[model samples]
Target: MFHKVVVTLLVVSAAVIYADVYEPVYKPEPLPYYFNYNVYDDYKGANYGQQEKSDGKAVYGSYTVDLPDGRKQRVDYTADHYKGYVAKVSYYGKAQHPKYYGPAVTFFNQYGNGYH
Candidate 1:
């Protein structure tokens, strides 16, 4: 029983050592690419655009969109293994909203009640 235990321990140690020394035969290289798109729909009141590029190590991009409040939102961003991700946001044009008033009373009784 002692001999069997010793043999099993030796086999396990050998496997651990071999695993530590093992290395992949092939390493895939990063691919670089770039893309951009824009959209403008006057009927739906939609306007936006985005562009991005990467050279394996780092990525850079920017996007812009029209806000419902009549303002344009813009964002510029960058990312990499070292810096991770960073973004700078800005707005263009003033925001405008229509004045709000209480619901209209189409019909009312003389007593100021909604029903007669």
Candidate 2:
């Protein structure tokens, strides 16, 4: 009877230890669950700035600002293996459309050509 009790106790303790060490697998839900989300903030009376997602390879981000004169200003930036780092600021709802400054200028301001 004592041997039977010891065997049963050991079995129960092993099961408890195994259960404590187990981890459940994680699975993400599908995209359709977010169909009612706020996708963009570009409309009138809406907030302008938002931070977007980034892939594993690149550090990517974007933001928008509503100008006082009814135009919208947007800035998109990224840093990765290909570009190192780049930023672009632009305007909308106006006649002026500026060009993209090259990455050299951006690098100069950030690190001063590696000397700073």
For candidate 2, write residues 8-67 as lDDT tens digits: 999999999999998879865423111112344555566555575555566667778767
Lowest lDDT 10-residue stretch of candidate 1: 107-116
Per-residue CA lDDT of candidate 1, range 5-60, in tens? 99999999999999999999998877899999999999999999999999988999
Off by more than 4 A, model 1: 1-22, 101-116
Q: Model 1 Cα RMSD, Å?
A: 10.0
Give TM per candidate: 0.67, 0.36
Shift in Å, residue 29, candidate 2: 23
- State each candidate's clash count: 0, 0
- By TM-score, who's the top model here? 1
Candidate 2 whole-model C-alpha lDDT, 0 to 1? 0.68
Residue pairs of candidate 2 with colliding backbone atoms: none
- The TM-score of candidate 1 is 0.67
Query: How does model 1 fare in lDDT?
Result: 0.95
